[model samples]
Target: MTAREQTEAYEDIPGTWVFDAQRARQGYHLNEFLYSLMKAANRAAFLANEAEYTRRFAMTEAQRTAVLRRDWNKLLELGGVSYALAKLAFTDGKSYQYMASRMTGMTEKEYVEMMLHGGRSPDGWRSRAERQGRA
Candidate 1:
């Protein structure tokens, strides 16, 4: 099927990405590298030579760059699943809040405050289709 055919658009729900089957297939190798972190030796080896580990996973250039740059949000945009990505964060001894804060362009305190306020307002956060409709 074509990309457009496989895609199903929905109303904007900020900071959410469904890890469906298509994403699962796309993320398999990346997830595999994250899961490998369950083993201390593998985790250590990866930290020692990130480029080598990335090459072993056969990650795309974009994915590899995201990994090297610690760009969690970009990794997700490139099809990395949240749960799978969590493993990478854990391997680095980082908390979920830290990762989420980074991904959302907020400090940990700001992220907490937003969550306490029931997340970001959706008032002006409509999807592209919605914006076009308004115009």
Candidate 2:
């Protein structure tokens, strides 16, 4: 398939975001700011003043707002790579499981229980077209 066709195919997948070139370019600054949290001093500055520390990056206003709100799913929608976004979770002294639970709109205990029960079923609408009854 052509690259455009491949990209469109990726778009059809429900609840999935491909970190393709377009997303990489769009999230560059946002990811950079997230990764910056790896530094102790940077984390300290961020903890001290989230809005101020966020201003140092060239992130979009929406990205800044999502970061401030700790909106994990919104960050993903905004093109943030999950791995990079994990830095923010860690900076907040939370576990990856906590961030992941938030992403799925579940409490950590619910997420853990779901995982223990063999995880989400793969039988449900796997794509937007399927969900919309077009496929």
Q: Which has the greatest lDDT?
A: 2
TM-score per candidate, in order? 0.78, 0.93
What is candidate 1's lDDT per residue for 4-81, written digit by digit as tens? 544555214345665667777887888887778788898888889988977888667888889888899888877798
Return the top candidate by TM-score.
2
Q: Which stretches of candidate 2 lie over 4 Å from their true place?
A: 132-135
RMSD of each: 3.4, 1.4
lDDT of 2 at 67: 98
For model 1, the stretches where C-alpha displacement exceeds 4 angstroms are: 1-6, 10-14, 121-135
Clashing pairs in 1: none
Residues 12-101, model 2: lDDT tens digits: 888778888888899999999999999999999999999999999999999999999998888888889999999999999999999999
Candidates' lDDT values, in order?
A: 0.78, 0.92
lDDT: worst 10-residue window of model 2:
122-131
